[model samples]
Target: MDQVRVAVIGLGMGFSHARTLAAGRIAGGKLSAICDLNPAKQEEAKATLPSDVKIWNDADALIASGEIDAVIIATPHYAHPQVAIKCLSHGLHVLIEKPAGVYTKQVREMNLAAASSGKVFSIMYNQRCNPLYKKLRELIADGELGEIRRMNWIVTNWYRSQSYYDSGGWRATWGGEGGGVLINQSPHQLDLWQWTTGMMPKRIRAFCSFGKYRNIEVEDDVTAYAEYENGATAVFITTTGEAPGTNRYEVTGDRGKIVIEDGKLTFWRLRVPEPEFNQQYTGGFGEPECWKCDVPISGDNPQHSGIIQNFMDAIRQGTPLIAPGEEGIHGLTLSNAMHLSTWTDHWVDLPLDEDLYYELLQERIAQSSSQKTVREVGPVDMSKTFGTY
Candidate 1:
């Protein structure tokens, strides 16, 4: 009971989690076990894993074995919720990767079990650990951007080739990963959109281009116009098809504007509120005075390793969770709404109808011709550590 024993399931992207725990980054935790279905992957894990690491072929057996106090679920999109439900049932703390699951209906089920289980449940939303984003969220919450007027995010730097899609049979497929850029590549941005702004879209008119730039069947490009509950309008644009792409997140309000890009947070503060300036000013050709400030960011952006350390801390130290597993539904719901908007060709409402979304997703799955080819995936790249809330 002195050391927190942890097991990471699904060795594809789970490799990073494994390596981090094996490195003894968390003073109270260590990589105790690993689970993967591929024999080839098992062999690959064996060579890199510590001498004391336990290996298992079946995830269900591994969860039920009671060999570890916590398990990080980095499996496929569809299996995320199911495996977490099982692990929580067996009294194991769970840290699941982003998007929770392919659909909200299933993710809701997982959330329900977590609510009843008295276990430490967290999500791998590592982007929340970024100091730049943390500052942005703090500014918005403090109303520095008074009466938020507009928000726009253009994150299109996720260029991927055919081999990347072919790297895994379950990737970018309707029945496999569910949706394309929206589901796979844009979850972090989507989560940050809602998380940083402290608002969810009331309605969304989304346009998603499926396979527009790739040979895959899921969306490669997406543009969405959203209206918040406070009557603020926002636009979100992302793609995996653009090279030398741009990542700009800006929000304009009555008092100030915040722009975050290239690892910097810039602020344009109005000397006078826009409404006050418009009402009191006699000039016809001028605007409010502004002060431009380059916000300085601090703290380490440990990302994936940061989330894992926090997860271990939550269990061992009773510290606060960075991203609770239950909150993941909001971002996934947003992603599903965008896809539903494209499917129905109209504006979709928030708190989306779960049954309707499930039915529509099933129809696409039934019609999809994409086949899944299960094979051994290699190690995780360094860029794979940036997903978050």
Candidate 2:
């Protein structure tokens, strides 16, 4: 196909995708259709998008109409894997939004379907498009940081008010969006945490505060400690309730340390590797000399549009995807482990027990008590929310 005709499945966050594709921003893709169950959203799309773009309220009908070559699933958290699986089974390429799914069991099923379908399956990990993170990943992969020793990310800048929660009934509830900050606000960072470092924790111990700052039933504050198999450890702290918050990620290794904060990348390079210096030092008080270097980052962060372009390239020109669908499970695995640790009040191991996780999640869903009146809030301007990582 010269142009991959794409349909976006939801109008909330997917509204931006629809506009970008309709505007011909991505060279190899065309916005053929848009789908949402909300008629108001459909009207909004019809009013803003081009007159020729097809609008449908039924996703199943649009999927079966053979009107599109690919689908971008931007529905709520639980429906991500469900819709992607259906789209893949129909022999269409699929691009799912982040956090994969609420749990790994469902995401595993979706990944298996993608594997068997032989279709281009990807996730909207837009942060991978950020040049700073790309450079960070390159450094870690090229061994510039040597063996990783520790990682700490304080990403509490995702502050949200009560109005934000009251804007949607399905948000911040176990029966709706599963978990809060980890699932919604911090998925990008969680994905970047493992993706940039090329490591997943062997075990995770987390503490989550449900509705501590809002009138919802899901976690809005979290602190998690993770241990890696290589003796490396990590600390992840986040909240949607803190103002004047901080966004900092620091990684320490045998060679030195790297810090990304305030939109700058700084590296402290040791004259010698710490292990080598320790072995050679004759004086007890002497330490390896360190030099501070400012790493220059250049390139525009295309964000969601960049992921869409990559998806199109992968489908039409056989280009590799920036964020493959299967790898999404790694980040979701970390999320599930955190939730499980909080639920069980114990340290959770990796390759999470999918069955037990599912069971516990169901219990939470049954016990959920979210009755906030949802206000009619228009589509959020997502441009303001990207690249803060």
Candidate 3:
């Protein structure tokens, strides 16, 4: 494929995006430009980026420059839609950071625009590249696990300290970062939860604990109950305050069960389908036997870089997307349902009420305590956070 020129906005997460898209790392990809509103960040990009990489303080001008064939938007939580819209308007392929937008309504606008742009629109849901998740989805889809009966995840290892929340005025505010962990740290899990299972909850009844673990107004602790259309149920539990937290994802089906944790996957396949065993087994006390095996996952997970490569390939060749930008709304629907359920203290239905969600979200913004428009922390080794992805 021919080389594709790319620019990244927001030096925050863009730091990783730019580095990953560097010319030598991926063939047919070029880190052509970097844009940020902060002049200091632009200067820093100049010092750190490749000499040939252009730096711009104005995103609009960079989008208009005709110098970049595509753009990676790593901007703040709320700016995703607008920035992506700008790129699509200019007929540029876009690879966007997750959470797609603060809400489904905004993401809908972006997705609609992408449809007209005829460009490769992808979201950075890089976890889809992980072999463990890949195998799990394969098993479920192949009916190796029969029909999914239950899904549960306790992804609390996304621990963040008070300083982490205080690092930016926009960190935890309802108006700023949307709704805390669900929007920021957990979009990956939320996306993976829905994607791996290939299921969408028809109903969500969640309990949110706001400021229970942090000093912010948004939720740091969330426990939700979800019921699928097929009568299967799921439980999602997460928090950002726990020390030495756990990351356990388990799925149970009629065939057997699968557990994924600590970078390992285990599958217990039933010798006979549960329905047959239950209906025909003559023994009163005997049940269908299960074969337990450790599902091996070989090769490193490509993660963010994988998504970028796929995006570039989609632009040049007709490759499939790891996570279509339009599908972002499914994960956001789960996140927004969790929040809206907690807000109304009732069940929230699928295809959430866009108007009601937007109205309630505004109430959250009205409660913000700080509105400073500056980043508090400096960039660190993002590899530590992304962790072998």
Top-lDDT structure, candidate number: 2
Q: At residue 210, what lDDT does model 3 achieve?
A: 93
Model 1 misplaced regions, further than 4 Å: 373-389
What is the TM-score (0 to 1) of candidate 2?
0.94
Global lDDT of model 1: 0.86
Clash count of each predicted structure? 1, 0, 0
Candidate 3: where is the Cα deviation over 4 Å? 372-389
In candidate 1, which residue pairs clash?
127-388
Cα deviation of 253, candidate 2, in Å:
0.4
Cα lDDT tens digits for candidate 2, 1-389: 79999998888889889899998999899999988877688788889999989988777778788889999888877777877877888899999988798889888989999999999999999999999899999999999999999999999999999999887766788877788999999989999999999999999999999889998888999999999999999999999999999999999999999999999999999989999999999998988899999999999999999999999999999999999999999888998999999999999998889899988888887776544211111233222211100
Model 1 agreement with the true structure over 234-294: per-residue lDDT tens digits: 9999999889899999999999899999989999999999999999999789999999999
lDDT of 1 at 196: 93
User: What are the models' TM-scores?
Assistant: 0.94, 0.94, 0.94
Off by over 4 Å in 2: 370-389
